[model samples]
Target: MCAASLPDTATFPFETAVVAGVGLIGGSVALGLRQRLLARRVIGYDANPEVLREAQALGVVDEIRTSPGEWLRAADLVVLASPMRTLSPLARDLAPFLSPAALVTDVGSVKSGITAEMEALGVRQFVAGHPMAGSERGGVTHARAALLENAVWVLTPGDHTPLTALSRARTLVEALGAAPVVMPPDAHDALVATISHLPYLASLALTHMVARDERLSLLAAGGFRDLTRVASGDPRMSRDMVVENKAALRGALARFRRQLERLEADLDDPEELLAAAAEGKRTRDSLPVVKRSLLPPKHDLVVAVPDQPNQIGAVTQALGASGVNIKDIEVLAIREEGGALRLGLESPEEVSRAAEILRAEGFEVRGRG
Candidate 1:
């Protein structure tokens, strides 16, 4: 569907949003929607009352529903953000209570299984979405307002999904500062198997390998730590994802094993192995970086200012007073005379505005490449 024909941006028609689970992804979605969208009310439903209360206390939801059926009846959009195992049964139970006009979607990592169940439950408006953004942290406490910023959110709409519902879902994702890409359900699963699931499995394997050795772990530094960091993910979550995407993940692992075997075979010859290692490093370094978000253009400008303690704050205040939004700010360099601070703005206009404001306030500011 064309973007213009979708829901009007002036008024978000979703009066009440029902979030089925109040974990990290669900809480973050509620917090982001409440902060950014025009929705009148947001309510949450979780099996655990403690989680429900915590979500309410954190201001992630306007109301907490003890019974999923009660709020599910009136919600305009119902999001299933539960763990993978509970998704199918929850969809079955909540299907009858959902309003006929309500649009439903899930934040589950695996899509094919849930999409089939949702279709079986007569949820014609269901769209499967996987937001490719997460931290090693878990639970509602780790939810952040900027969690979805610059993230790639993939939507896998089923054959029966209505155009109107897909449009609304896209708008909701975009409002939370994510770029949406549409793909088929199986295709989405295949891509994530290589990029997401296989990597987690590899991390777990690497961690296990290192743990089996006593001496190597003692000497392990940043390289090993960085490579195995994802192994710290919740065991239950990792297990669920691996099981759901096993077929695709197995294929990915097989391909990866062939590469590993090649390297292992070349280990007998030191010169050949060194050449292989150098080639791998060159290929890795030459790959282009991914800039995932399409919401707004960003530009970095460097400005030199005095090294005084309050100088940074003074410049920031001046920019704020001039109504300029600072996307990011960093101390790029510190010289004997002064330091250069890099400022990231949404556009060149905001950069120019900030520069003018700082200069007018008697701070020496210049744009840097």
Candidate 2:
């Protein structure tokens, strides 16, 4: 970011950093603090003494506190990585110790409950967030500084949340090499149910069904292994997620069942089944493996170009020379003389810069954000 674009309040150099749970997400946050030099001092708090000692020894934190009361007042930024069940009461308990200006955030998957707690506190300094990155493992032993790199960390800020607090959350997320995505709590919960939570349940069911049939296990292939990997995640955590997000999970499961029924019906028709698989392949192939947003959401811009070779190369070279990274690009249409190229970029700044470069090169550019 340019100097003019920088916020008046500096984003880094947090006076004190506190990780409340000191487990996977919390330990990773502490490691990120040290790695980025974002905090002058780091402290960790966990209910388990062994986890705390292990985390400190791993250099995840500069110090380990027996309790939040010992360190909360001094913390300029606090990350609560505890179980969702404990968040509401914990936040209320920590409220007395936190500074008026201190920023509070969490890594909870289910957002609506904790976000409601933050709202109940009547404090604008709270920002609700959930990082879309994790392994089948849990605990600080699995935590690393690079855990969040290139991950999509969703920031669910309610209308009552202060812009400054939300921006502070974003800065911290970016510093950890994760992209910050703004979303509402209900929307985030619903989306995750479809893409994350429900999938875990599906994987678990598939794994159980195959295990019950000894013959099926012997015939399991790479596809089965890959699809069932998420079922290996911490059972206790998965149970909590299922119970907490039951409303959304039920809806997602219903949709999944409907799709499955359609597929089962198509099994009798070879042509229909083949068509469905072909369409699915095309859709899946077009999706990026990992969404690594450096600064902005990917926006598509359609530009008219001649139906000629080297035209796409010229546009890419122009944008690349101007320091604008194109996230994705595709040829849309071809007329007798020209065609349209759709270029994907991060922000309006890139769109403006890219369009200037393209127009200078005698190509018609169009932008939509």
Q: Report the CA-based lDDT of candidate 1 relative to the real structure.
A: 0.80
- Most accurate candidate by lDDT: 2
Could you tell me the lDDT of residue 127 within candidate 2? 92
Question: Which sections of candidate 1 miss by over 4 Å?
Answer: 1-11, 265-279, 287-369
Global CA lDDT computed for model 2: 0.82
Model 2 collision count: 0
Instruction: Estimate the TM-score for candidate 1.
Output: 0.73
Q: Residue 95: error of model 1 in Å? A: 0.8
lDDT per residue as tens, model 2, 111-221: 888888877876569999998777657789898877888788999998788899999999999988888899999899999899889999999998998987879997776
> What is candidate 1's lDDT per residue for 1-369, written digit by digit as tens?
112233644466577788888888888888877777636677888888999999888888888986656557788888898888999988888898888888799999988999999888889889999988777677888887578877889999988888888998998888878889999888898888988799898999889887868898986665677668778878888899989989888889999999899889998988999999899989864543344344433466677777578878887787887788876776652322227776777777777777777777777776632
Candidate 2 colliding pairs: none
